[model samples]
Target: MALPNRLRRLLLGSDPRLARMLGYWAATCLLYFIGAALLILQVRAGAADHDSAVLLIGIGATGVAVFAVLVRASIVMGIAPSTLAAWQALFAIACNIGAYVVTGPLRGVYLIFLLVVLVFCTFSLRPRHTMLLCAYTLGILGATMVWLVATYPATYPAYVEGVHFASAACALISVTLLTGEMSKLRLRLKQQKEDLLAAMATIRKLATVDELTSLANRRHMNEVLVAQERRIDPAGQPTCLALIDLDFFKSVNDRYGHAAGDAVLRAFSAAARSELRAQDVLARWGGEEFLLLLPATTMTQAILVVERMAERVAAAPVAEISGGMRITFSAGLAQRHDREPFADTINRADKALYNAKSTGRNRISLG
Candidate 1:
């Protein structure tokens, strides 16, 4: 039968592991139902005992109903997936024990079901919990064998029961060791996948971000410029590019050492970032030179933005540059020409910046 929508969603939520567990349980239950029906047909034909066939069918139906209730309760109560899996394992063990009691320990094939349950638990349960379940299963099987021998001594002799017990114990131990190894391998692979993702993130950051100033690096800036160029249109608002150069930056480094120069660069980058709009792209073009891309802006607005940035940098002296040494920058603004190549646009800005430096420092010039 199909599950209700709400219950189906609860069992098959965002976690794939939970969905797989529920799917496996449903399939196993269906198989058990089919097996019990076959047993009933055999009983009708006098190939199997009628009482055992009836008992098996009853147990299978009850087990299915109980499992459905447990699944619903776990989802409704927001039980942890691992905890739910543990509960399911315990229920499976109980069902196996019940089946063994009905069919007699020596004749029952329920130990095969127990092995399958153990294998399923290995996927969701921890190694210790799986091991504990294995121990519990072995204990239950051993106790069932002793009880059968004590009650039906003629049918289950001590020597015969001992051989069966030894064989079952060996099989359980082998499966436990195998599943434990498989679990360890799965965990290791999961860890490796996580590590690989972390490394990829680090590499991407290093490729696009400047180490010294934490601004977008030149390569990334060029890519951004190209993307903006493709988006430009004569009918839309104009795009502007600004080339900024730190005035007398070499002197700062030569006078105060490279460390102080680095401090100044970082301070300037931070100040410019704080003053600019979120849409503006600020990148370190090279030593002491930064590029700013302002989309949907005119040349006049770009100039005003650069002038404000210059004021901010001059007002806030770099702390590391002893004696509160002040810093200034010269910028050149250029409006992107209709369908013009991005490189040509950048060249125009660069020329204007040179003009600003040659004419005077700490001012904005239009290209």
Candidate 2:
């Protein structure tokens, strides 16, 4: 069943809170078994009567077994960790109260168990919930104190019982305040960490990406080129670099406006992107100029790819740029040589691009 599988996983999983809960359960069971044994020993030695011993041992054992079963069921049912902790704290308080009543002659020792449970709750429950549990605990202990004084007026005087209650209440309130502050500090630190991570991500994006066109900037493209060049081998597939310049880009800016020029650049980028493969890198090299890096591509293949892109750019009019204007670009592509620097290859491509511009525009020149 799903329940069994979940229970097994919770028990075997590496979640710190769940592991701590299991340890808490085991410690409580061990304490119950120890208490039960002590009560049996006391009965045998005649230090305690049979009825009292049976009452204490029977209630403790039954409570421990029931709580163990509930813990497993809670895990199987996928109860929230905080809810499970609250339930455990409540169960511990109930057992403490029950033990106090059953072992009335040994009530002093039982109150220690109540204090221990309060301490455990401080760490496990939220501040508000822990405060509420403390109030409930104080109320029950106050009632038990009243009952004890009534049952044995000679032993537990009113003044002595008042002092004991006051001391325990002070201890509970101190722990609650301290733990509450710690929890708040922890939450603040976690939020700060997340905010810092978000800021770092924004900074990284700005450093590597162009703000206008959402493409890799010149610096990032240079890094990519260097990395690709290092990967070159004599037997491996070749890499090609292409430099693209928008023909008469300044005329569009002068005739229409800078906004129209910006629009045309964006339109050209979008059109060219569609013609390129996913692995191809496109970067805005400078004003009105772009760089394209084609990995595992030959000179012929890179030229064909650029030719198709140029055809597309010419056929399509950039919408809303000077009331829909057709534009073109000139490109020069060069393949990387064995052990050659990327700067040399880029220089050759730039020279070829100058030749393309001098001869005419709207064409690609291979170097």
Candidate 3:
């Protein structure tokens, strides 16, 4: 238990992603350990100098410590994680090249580290940066080979160095070029994933929202009713409901145009929404009809809310219509008691709406 908690704290401080980066570095550190062991073996066989090996290994160990400080500083300075990762790859490349320069007769084996660095860069950096790093690696390794031959012909011959440089160039260049294409493919797939997620969000809005009134449509209203029903059962509270219909709505479309009727509908929705509390939900049931839902409310409170809706609609005129027309609505109010299903309350409200229409056009009927 102690070990798990400590590990959790180390890996999941403020950023778990940074922990992942540290884990990647830990994995690569195994290569450093393996290279150190090989260096010791080369020293014992007299193929490499002990002092030069110790100096290079010391530098590599110090570079790892510097990497930790730089990463910590990057967080304080608000550096991006990807950019930090690129810096790590570059630092490792430098350390690997330094080792190759000092390793003498065992330099051929150390060249594998450069190939590993190229692979790491392909994932951590951009394709362009990866290509540049690959080119840089090839150039530096080639230069190191030429310098060793010129300075120490007894230990390093030009003919042998020429063949080694040729082989390293072909292998490193081939791997980098192939990995660059893979990097491009990865970027394209990532963009397509973002596009697909955005499309899904738009589709969800279309499914539950009325485009004309910009209000919650019937499907969404039903879901809201079910959710409210669940809360009411446990809380022992009443939920108020109102089914509203605009009086003489078809006449507005006939007298003016359908466009003007749309404007009137939009205006009514806006006015009613402004009169509602934050917890209240008002959705378009169909053409010129809306359902207003109030969670944890009594009949008296719900009636006041509906009254305010009526007053606001009367004051706000539809600009698209001639004479800046105002509208009136007939509403049927119902209250759902604790443990009562929403379907029963909604059915009663629908019947009461029919009564409001029969009695007079613009009044609220209680059921």
TM-score of each: 0.85, 0.73, 0.91
Give each model's whole-structure lDDT.
Answer: 0.81, 0.79, 0.82
In model 1, where do residues sit more than 4 Å from their true spots? 1-11, 14-18, 30-78, 104-107, 154-160, 232-235
Which candidate's TM-score is highest? Answer: 3
lDDT of 3 by residue, 128-168 (tens): 88888888878778888788889998888898888878888
Clashing pairs in 3: none
**lDDT by residue for model 2 (63-150), tens:** 7777666666665678876787787778777766765555534545656766667666655677788789888989988998898789
Ranking by TM-score: 3, 1, 2
- What's the lDDT for residue 306 in model 2? 94
What value does the lDDT take at residue 184 in candidate 1?
86
Stretches of candidate 2 exceeding 4 Å from the true structure: 1-80, 95-126, 143-161, 232-235, 311-319
Model 2, TM vs. native: 0.73
Compare the candidates by lDDT and give the number of the best one.
3
For candidate 1, give the lDDT: 0.81
Give the distance in Å from residue 267's predicted Cα in candidate 2 to where it truly belongs. Answer: 3.0
Arrange candidates by lDDT, highest first: which order?
Answer: 3, 1, 2
Q: Which tens-of-lDDT digit does each residue in 126-165 have in candidate 1?
A: 7777888889888988898899789988877888778877
